[model samples]
Target: MSPLGRPVSLGGGVANRGQVFRLGAAVRRPVTPHSPATHALLRHLSRAGFDGAPRLLSADDRMEMLSWIPGVAARNPLPGWSLSDASLVSVAVLVRRFHDAVRGFDGGPHHWPRPVPPAYSDGLVGHNDLHPGNIVFDGERAVGLIDFDLAGPSGVVWDLATVARCWCPLVADADLPDGFVQGPERRYDRLVMLLDAYGLNRAGRVAVAESLVDNHDWTYRIVTDAASAGHPGFREYWAGVAARTSRARQWAVDHQAELIKAVRR
Candidate 1:
C-alpha cells in the first residue's frame, strides 16, 4: 500500500521511525495510540485558526493520514534562511502558539509511546521533540511542527529547552557536524533572544537553564535506548554520539552562570 503512493522523502530525520508517504492530498504514518491525540490536536489547531500545524484527515489500522503541508523541513544542507535570527524567532513564536493552542485540550486515555518525565507532566502538554527536523519552514519562517509522536504531558520549560538545544543549537563546537554552520560564539545572546522571543519570564528562564542540561542527557538516553531496541535510524545516529552528548552536557554545565545572566536581563 505504501509503495503505491509517492514517497515524500524530504531529506532525512532522526525520528523518521514511520515509513511516511504522500498521497493525493495527505501524508501517512503508522498508527499509534498517540494518533487519536494528534488528530485531536490537529482539530483544535484548525478551530483555533493556527495554520502552523498539519491537519489530521483519516486513519486506519495500519496508517494515519494528515494534510500534506507543503514546505521545507530543516535538513542537513540546512537552508540559509533557516539559520537566521528571524527564523529562530518565528519558530519560537510558533512553539509558543502551539503551547497556547494545546494548553486546555484534554489528552486522557492516550498512551504516549513513552512516559513523560514526572516533573514536566503536571500541567499542559508539550511537543517533546521540538526541533528543526520536526519543523516545516516557509523561506525563513517556521510554518508548522510535524511528527507529534512524542507530544505528551510536559511543561513549557522542558519543551522550550529542547528547542533551545536544537535551535539555538546548544552544542559544543567540537560536536557540531561538518557543513553545519551554527557555532558557539554569542550563544548567551542567542539564548536570551530565544527566551525573549518565547516570552519566558525570569522564573521560566531559570527553569529552562536547568532543563537544558537535563534534557541533553535525557535525549542521549532516549537515543541509546532506541538504538539498543534495534531502531535503525537511532542506531546509526548513536554510533559515535556518546562523546558529543557528554560534551554537550558539559557545555551546559560550564555555561550555567552565563545562561542565568542572559535570562536575568
Candidate 2:
C-alpha cells in the first residue's frame, strides 16, 4: 500500500487547485480569502446530507484539510470520456442534486466568494464553477465536486448557465478540444440534453440562456483581474486563452437566440 501522509500532487488546472496535494485520505491546499466561508458551507453540506462535497477536516492560516473524495478529476486536454453525452448528463444530474441539497443552507454568516448579480442571487449557495476539472467522476457518474473557491449564493439558473457555458460549451470552434468538436445543431442538442437532464422548466431554460452572456463576461473579468494581479497560474493560463475567451464572449452573444430556442424546445 502507498505510504500514508505521502504528498501526491493532483492536477486539474494551472491555478491553486492544480497545486493541491493528497496526503493519505485528506487533501491539503493553500487557504484563500474564501476558505473560511467554504469550510462553513462544507460543514453545512455535510449536515444537509450532501455526500458529493468534501467534508471539512481541519485548518489553520496557511492551509485547510478536506476529506479526499475518491474519483478521478479530468484535467486539461480533457479526456474523450469526460466530454461524452453520458458524462454531460451525469454532471447535470449531480448539479441538480447539489442545488436541492442546499435548500435550507444559511449563507449569511460566511462571506462567500464570487458574488453574482443581485438578480441572480436566488439565495442558493451553488458550485458556480462546474467545469469538468472540478467534478469527480466514477465510471460515467459524477460522484463529487471538489472546488469551492467560487461557490456562492446565486440563482439556480445562473449556476446552470455556467454549466451550459462550459459543457454545452458556448465557445468558438477554434477553442474546442478534439473530443468536443460539434456542429451548431449538435451543440444546441447537447444544451437541450443538459437542461432536460437537469429538469429545468421553460422559465428556467429561458433564464439560463439569458444568463449565458453575463456569465461569460463575469468569468472573463474574474480571470483577467486575477491575471492582472499577477496570479501566476491565471497569468499563464490567461495569456494563452485571452484571445480565445474574447471569441467565446462573442460567440455567446451571437448564439444567444439559438441557445434559448434549443433549451426551450
Q: Model 1 over residues 90-118: C-alpha lDDT tens digits?
A: 98999999988887777765666565668
Global lDDT for candidate 2? 0.84
Candidate 2 lDDT score at position 259: 81
- Model 2: per-residue Cα lDDT over 1-265, one tens digit each: 3455889888756568566899999988888988888888899899989999999989999989899999898765667787789989998999998998888988888888778888888888888887778889998789999888898888798888888878777788777767775565677888889999999899988999999888878877888898999899889889987888889889889988888887777
Off by over 4 Å in 1: 1-7, 15-18, 76-79, 176-183
| Candidate 1 residue 244 C-alpha distance from true site, Å | 2.4
Candidate number of the best lDDT: 2
lDDT of 1 at 183: 61
Among these predictions, the greatest TM-score belongs to 2
